[model samples]
Structure formats: structure tokens, C-alpha cells
Target: MVVACCFGMIEVVCVEAKDIQSAGLGPVTLAIDSGSCTGLTGPSGSGKTRLLRCLADLDCHEGDVSLNGASRESFTPPEWRTQVGLLPAESFWWSERVLDHFPYKQKPELDSLDLSPVVFEQPLRQLSSGQRQRLALLRLLANQPKVLLLDEPTANLDQDNIMRVEALIAAYRNQHRCCVIWVTHDRAQLERVADRSLTMANGRLDGDSS
Candidate 1:
């Protein structure tokens, strides 16, 4: 299904996975609509991250995933991943300087996260955990992905920064009409951001009862 919005035509099922199964996770099915946020919460090692990886095609798993009605098999791994971006808890930095990783000039989004322009000049090694987490989110948004798979995106931030990140993601989704699948342990945070919430247990999504 599709819908017309300010961002143009958006697929209701922007992301769909049928029978997705990984080593630790059971066969799972999920459908996420554009401009909506779905919260996924589970105990540690319950395969929440694995499910996100499967959706991003970052790991080998059974079943199929489609984005915008296009099957994952139709595109190259890199091409598919560009449309369905995953922001892991611990972000990896390849270059020494931060600016080298970004192709275009910085935008005001940085300031919204309370990040200074000088942060672009700093080396990756010098950044704190929270800094890396916030910068990682910025990097993901720069890609202009249709779907976002976030795993504990605000784990390292304080309450103030957490709200900042949540607002930034909400604003971005509203503007782009993108789909968001956020995995977090905080129930209150889930309520704040997710249009619908689901709980995972023993590697399977149990219910939206949360």
C-alpha cells in the first residue's frame, strides 16, 4: 500500500520482512509503514539487534526483506543498505578526522544536538561515547535513507540529550516520511517516540501489549 504525503508518495509498507530468522532469533515477520516509528524492546541477548541486522541485510538470515516493494535480492548489498540504513549502538570510525567521513558541508542539525562546529575537526579517537553516539545518528541521517534501523541509539546520552535525539529523529521522519524501527530498553522512551510498540522474547516478537 502507498500514500501521498508532503514528502511525496510514500509506501505504507516501506519495509517488510517475512519469516526472518537468525542464529539466536526465531522466524519473525514485520511490516513497517512510512512516517511511522515502531518500538522494539527485549531483554539483553534476546536477538533484538540481530533482527535489525537482518532487516538491514548486514547478516545472513533466512526469509526475505523488501523495501518500497523492491526485493532485497534485486539490488546490490551496498545499494540496498543505502536505502535501509542501520545505526548500531557502537559506531565505527574509519578515518582519523570526522569531516573526512562526510561528503557535504555540515548543516544546522549539529547545533540542534548541542554539537559545536569544532567537533568536525576533532579526531575520532578523542570523542566520548555519547559524542560518538550522537555523531553516528547524524551520519545515518546524512544518507537520506528510506528506512532507519536504530539499536539503542541513545544508550550513552543523558536525559537532556536523549530528548534532543528523539526530537531530531521525529522531525526528520516527519519531513521525509521515512520508516523507523527503533530498538530500546526504555519503556518511557518507547512511549514517547513509537506510534506502536512491541516486545520481543526468546527471539520472537510477542505482542504490542506494551
Candidate 2:
């Protein structure tokens, strides 16, 4: 899809991973178009998470990953991470107060996740797992990343909250035309959110007929 960037109406291939290989996984190549979501499903140890880490340049792996046609090597690690953000299955909070981790206190994105502004005043240890998960997502979105690598983003939430998170993600993708690589175990979720689905087995990905 065409997006209006600083250069004015440029064609951006949101994400492209060429010959990506990590422990147990074979060479994997895939391209995710702008404003699209790709569902990745696989067994517990099938390297699904590893693949995302590789794409985020978080893990040591052999691959060529590019965002908006710019190679991973072109940017500093922090710069690249800001543009291609990854939300791990379990988020970590380094600060005592929840607000300390965020750059700013006010963000409209918080409301979409059903987070009250008061949450910023609470201690990180007081928040439940589900709350932390939702907050993590909000933090990621606040960066306005060009691509999102989400690993089981809704795993800790109830059905209602899961739908809320999904809706927020879909809205974000539509607004920014960003690419999403979502790792999910729920086939129904894949059907609901993804434009395409792929299954990983023994470190290799294949198209999913389901």
C-alpha cells in the first residue's frame, strides 16, 4: 500500500525477512505488506518466538531484516528497535512506579486499552498480569513504530479484554499502515485478525490451510 511519508506517497514494504535462521529453524523468508497482519502458529518449541526475536534483532541469528526497505544494519540498535518494536510474551518493568517507564504521563492510547489514568500512579508490583500486558501494548504503540512484533499479546486477558486488545491493534494498523507479525496459538484468532496464516514445525514455516 502507498503511504504518505516525509518523502510524500512512498511504497513501503512494512517488513521483510530474508533467509532468517536461528537455532532449530531453517532458512525462513517472508515479506509483510504495509497495513497487514500475518498470524504465526506453531508448537511450543517450534521457534516462532525465536523468529520474531531474529526479526527484531534481539537474538543472535543469521538473517537480513529490513523495515521500509532499510536494512537492519543501517540503524543503531535502539533506533531500529524504536521503529520495529517487539512485545514479548512476558513484559518486564524496570521502574518502581508504573509511570516511570513511560516517557510521558498522558497518552490517548491508554483509554483504548481501558486503562484509567490513575494506573500511572500505581506501583508496578500492584498491577495484575493482565494489566501489565495491556500496559505493555500501550507502551509499544506510544512509540509509533512502523512494525509490531507481538508474541501472545492477549494471552493473559479474558475474552472481553482479548477482543479489546485485538480491536486496538487493528485500529493502530489501519491508522499507521504498519505491519504486524502476531504469534498466536488460537486458530480462531488467526482467522479473525490475520490476512494470512503460516504454521511452523521443526523450525520451518508452511502455509496453513486452516
Candidate 3:
């Protein structure tokens, strides 16, 4: 719970979780600094996705999570989600039309993900899996979230698209000072994007690498 106090404002840790306990994971503690990316990697079924769900408050868990020094309790579930956006392995779309899922008159930086604006006019069913994945990220970013919980966001993309997605997220982190917890199995991707990386195994975190 260490935090810097300056002029009655706390601008130190961007995200903090204490003793987080959830399905496939338990009693985990970690902190993410503002405007930095932290990579979490491990074998399949190592509880990475559950950890992200717990942090996003989408899964039942025993823990304390806070953003910008404000406890998650301070906001309702929906409100908290707006600040802590989660991009799941597979994104869900409620509307058949691509544009319906996004904010009206709001143009996402589509080019950053190698998407043309015309794609927005197409039907959701017409989009490829990779295209949908990219659009889902853009939709999440449209909220300008302070924290991003990404679960293998580039898994469906090719190498070029992977680079594009990484660059886009890096740019967002730089421009908005967004805190990120990127869960991936790609060691190469981890090295490229993470300021520091941690390994999770058997419901615990260890093996710190920078």
C-alpha cells in the first residue's frame, strides 16, 4: 500500500491488487506503475485469464483492486469497467453492423491497425477474425480507459498486424499514460512491449524478468 503523497494527490501507482484470490489463482499481489506495460506469461491454464478477469471485476474474487488510488469499491461495476477496460481473447459483438458497436461520430485510429475506414461500413459477419479482433481493441480504446487488461490481443493477427497492434497500444499508453497488463505466451512480444515481465505458474507469480 505504499504510495507517494504530493500536494494531497496521489499519482504514483496506476493499478494495485492485494491478495487477489480467484478461480485458478489466489492470493496474488502486484502493482502496475502509471504509463507502463507489465507482461504476464506462463503455460496454458496457468490462470492468466482469470487474473485479468478478477482485476476487471468480471469474476468473483477475494482481493482489493484500485485505480489511481481509488478503490474499485468506489465505483459501480459498469463505472469501474469504463476505467479498466478488458479485451478478452475473443471479443463479443452485439450488433450485426460493424459501426453499431462503436460510438457515433467517433473515429478510431483504424490505420494504426492496418484497417481502412471502409471496414466500418461492412457487416460484422463479413469481417475476418483478425479484423474483428482489431476492431474490438479500437472499441475498447474508444472509452479512453486508464487501464487496459489485454488477453492475447494479437493472437489472431499475422506478424505485421501484431506489430501494428503493439505499436497502437504503445502509442495509447504514451499519449494517455495508460497502465497495461498484457497477458501473452509470446516471449518475443513480451520483450518488445513490457517494461518488466513476470511469470505465473500454479496459481502464483514468480520469475521476474526485465
Give the Å error, residue 41, model 3.
Answer: 0.2
User: Which residue pairs collide, candidate 1?
Assistant: none
> Which candidate model has the greater lDDT, 1 or 2?
1
Most lDDT-accurate candidate:
3
Q: Candidate 3, residues 65-181: lDDT per residue as tens digits?
A: 999889999999998998999999998999887777777847777888899888868888889999999999999999889999999999999999999999999999988988999
> Ten consecutive residues with minimal summed lDDT in candidate 2?
1-10
Clashes per candidate, residues 3 or more apart or on different chains: 0, 0, 0
TM-score, every prediction: 0.92, 0.91, 0.93
lDDT for position 61 in model 2:
87
Q: Give candidate 2 regions above 4 Å deviation.
A: 1-12, 105-108, 208-210
Candidate 1 on 1-210: residue-level lDDT in tens?
455666576456889899999898979998888898999998998889999998989889999999878899998998898889999989998888787666475553688798887777778888888988898899888888899999999999999999999999999998888999999999899989998888899999988763
lDDT of 3: 0.90
lDDT of 2 at 209: 50
Error of 2 at 167 (Å): 0.7
How much is 100 displaced in model 2, in angstroms?
Answer: 1.4
